[model samples]
Target chain A: MGLVNSIFATVQFEILRVLTLRRLSVAVIMALFPPTMIFWLQAGGALASPGFIITLFCGMVCLLSLLLWSTSNVYAELEGKSWAFITSRPYGRWSILFGKFLVAFLVSFIISWIALSLCMLVTGDLDFNILNDGKEVPKMQVWLALSGLLFLASMVYAAIFSLLGVLIQRRAMAIAVVFFTVVEVVFAVIPAVVGKFAMSFHMFCLLTHWVGWVPPSAGQDEDANEILQDFLNVYGRQDAWVHLAVIFAMTLLSLSLAAYVICKREYITLEDSQV
Target chain B: MIEFHNVTKLYKTVIGVNDISLKIEPGVYGLLGPNGSGKTTFINLVMGQLRPSMGHLSVFGMDPWQNDGLLNRIGLCPAIQAHYPFISGLKWVAYLTQLRGFSRKQSHQMAAESLAVVGMEYAMNRAMSSYSLGMRQRTVLAQSIAHKPELLILDEPFNGLDPKGRYEMTVFLKSWVKEGRSVILASHILHEVESLNPSLLLVSGGRLLASGSPQQVRSIIANCPNSVRVRCRQTAELAALVTGNFEIKSISINSEAEELEIESMNPLELLKLLPGLAMKNNLLISELRSSDDSLQNIFSMLMLIHRGGMRLPE
Candidate 1:
């Protein structure tokens, strides 16, 4: 119980510091970019497809939320050498790791939801006439599904980056490159079977189904219909659920292992750590 | 109380700590060793940060490695060349107190008091990033004593303190010991530890060379001559008489000042015979000082003796 309290205290302290330093402000501002741009384009009647705007908003929220939360809570802490203060205390190492996980999770979750809410409000106010193709999906249900997928994406990315923060010294650059070049782009181009391994792909597929992008006739356009069918099939598959579950499990496992390593390792001197 | 039984910590190709066995009682214990002599490693082992490769270590009747409960009663002020830039001095101390299980209100109160004790109350609100090296050191000291644990371990506590600050800290540490608590102070500065009058643990090359009272440790230094200075009005007369009567190693007279420096083979006998000699010579003795009993001389002698006697394996 004491350990838990200490961990929470540390998390609160760090969040307060990060917020005060204006470090997260830039990221929070960046989260609004996709929605703002989508709204502006819609106002100008320049938006090609309304469905694409929603997809862009969802992707942007997931990507930006993951990047911001991971950097602030995990990468920044390591670079700041703040762990030394926590590790020197009597609290268990697992408590510290879990505390950080909770903070990053909550921050990303809240920011992503806020961005999605704004996007929904803007689309509703504008009466953009999205989903007018005679496919009846409730607006609230669609928003919920999109939000859920964003939440999952944020969790997986935050966890992976948290582990990277612990294992690698230069974690920020590593996460940035991996997030942009590999997880975001490469996974989208891969086949459904292979793409499910990537967090971004699972989220993209899940959002597509919730938005009712599945076509009626299999012969209308083979490639488009096949992509839509793959989305529906993979979303319902037990294997996809298991993949998300595994990623979540690995996050906990990896974090715990890192905590154990830090607890036992001797910090020979403060001299070795530049931060 | 702390006990180490033939403990050894090895890091791959390098040795962190060699076979070290000692029992520390309730008082100040000075861990005197040069840099890379494993002082920090020894402290980390006691704190359970590092596992010993061989043997056992127990603090307060529990193995620190597996015993989180024992840590509640221990306080540590690590060397302060490293610190978090974003934290304020007060916040740093308060956070550590919170980790020790104090409530937020209680921790804040303790933090304020600890900072005051270390004479850092004025700088409490300032960010550590803006603090000078000496102020940062004081903040570290404040954090260590915030909880007032049964045992306190300080690594080079006086590293960057000015003389006045050092004096204040030494006095506070002395009083802390009087409350039946123990403190283990590690430092390369022998004089700083000497002021605390602590039981000594001397290490070199990752090995414990001697462990006992400062006086006893000084005696372990072999082949080091002890010198005594006697200041009297008739210094020339006393020097001439003493040289003939006793087997004086050497004598030097200060012509400008009335004083005689006598190098003796045995400092203990010289100290014992000083009053008698003063009375016989009818000399008004203003002062009598022994150079060998000083910490600087004792530390140098210990280092020299160890270097001459011990042989490291190639």
Candidate 2:
């Protein structure tokens, strides 16, 4: 119980620091970049599909910013030689990593959500008439589904990056690039079972099922959001619940690996921190 | 409070610490050694930051490596050159204390009190990066003591302090010892370690050479011969008088240089007797000093023994 509270206190302290005027301003700029760019493209009359644009923005810009922050959580300690402060605490290593991971995830999720809402400001009347001639799906449902996907993506990406920090903190930026380029982007873009291993794979499946273009049916509103309504299996491309479970499981697995490494490895900072 | 049995820590091809055994029933113990003498490695073993390549170590009767309970009872003020730039000293200490299971109110209160004790209360709100070296050292010390652990380990805590800061740290450490908590102070400087505690463990070349109070260490070296040099008009007379004393093991005089060299088993006693003897001989002792610094001699002896080329007197 004390450990849990301690973790929360750390997260609280970190989040506060992270949201300081200077860092928060940078976060806001980065978060709003996607929507601002989308708005500009739409104004230029060169915008193709808004869904594709928004998803790309979330995956690329939002994920990158979040990944950068989460990865830095561990590397910052190393670079600053402040790992002693956290490792020397009674709650120990795992709690420290978990606290960092949580703060990063929450910060990224909140910023991304704010960015999504800002996009709505430009997209206008997102009582969106994204129709494929099927039964009308409410705009509220579309928003809810997109929000869920964003939340899960934030969580999964944060965990993976946090794991990378635990594994190879000194090379965090370089490893992050390799992981993002190879796994999240290239693997996710390709249509293979191997892509299923990436967080983007589940996100793409969820996106497709939630807003996939459906075949035209008679006696249906022509300008309605055509979305799957199987609450448990919303994106029936594959089971959404199963994908959710996989993502959560991967988070747990990554967290466990991080904890194990932290507990077992003899970090120089820890050794030299002896008072 | 701490124990090591045949503990050896090997880093690939180099041995950071060699086979050794020790038990510390601590009030305050100074770990004295030069750079690369395994002081940090030994401290790391005690803190459970590293596992022994062979043998075993225990602190507070629990294994330190990943032992959260044991760690909770220990506080460390590591010897670091800098502090985190982004976090204020107050926040860092409070956050660490909170992690030690203290309530938010308690953590903050303890942090404030600890900072006050270290005379850092005025600048506690400032980011650590803004602090001067002395201030940073104080802040680090504050964070370690905020939890009020049973044992506190300070690794060269006075490394970068100004003279006044060093004096204040000595006073605080003295008071802390009076409070009956255990402390392990690691330092390279002899006088500094001597100032903190008479009891010490000296290491050289990754091996423990000596362990005892200052008086005991002095006694061990009492009969070890060391050279005393003298330049005087009456070198012959001075050498004759000095060599006659049992404390003086041998003597040689050079009339050409008006110099006298005496090797003494009991150098302190010989030193005490020199002036009296010189006066009796009516010798003008223009210059007189021991060429041998005792600390350096002890270290040389230890290294010799470590290399298996010399035997330490039982």
The list of candidate 2 runs beyond 4 A from truth reads: A19-22, A125-143, A189-192, A213-236, A270-275, B219-277, B286-298, B311-314
For model 1, how does the per-residue alpha-carbon lDDT over A1-275 read when each residue is reduced to its tens digit? 67777787777765756664466766567568667877897789776554456656656666666565554443454355554455557773545556666677777777767777777777764432334244555667767876787677667666666655555545564566575677557875576555655666655555554564523322234455466667556555444466567667756775666676556555433432111
lDDT of 1 at B136: 86
TM-score of 2: 0.85
Candidate 1's displacement at residue A53, Å, is 5.8
Best by DockQ: 2
lDDT (Cα, tens digit) per residue for candidate 2, span B46-101: 77777888999888788887777787788888777555567788887888788888
Instruction: Please give the CA lDDT of all the candidate structures.
Output: 0.70, 0.76
Instruction: For model 2 chain B, give the 10-residue run with minimal summed lDDT.
Output: B217-226
lDDT of 1 by residue, B1-314 (tens): 78999998887657777888888877889998877778878887888877788999998888987456777688888774546567788887887778777777888999999999888989898888898888888888888888888899998898888888788888889888888899999987777888778998987667787788878765554235567888878878878777876656899988568888898765565667766876877877788888566445655555555667532111
Pairs of colliding residues, candidate 2: A275-B153, A275-B154, A275-B155
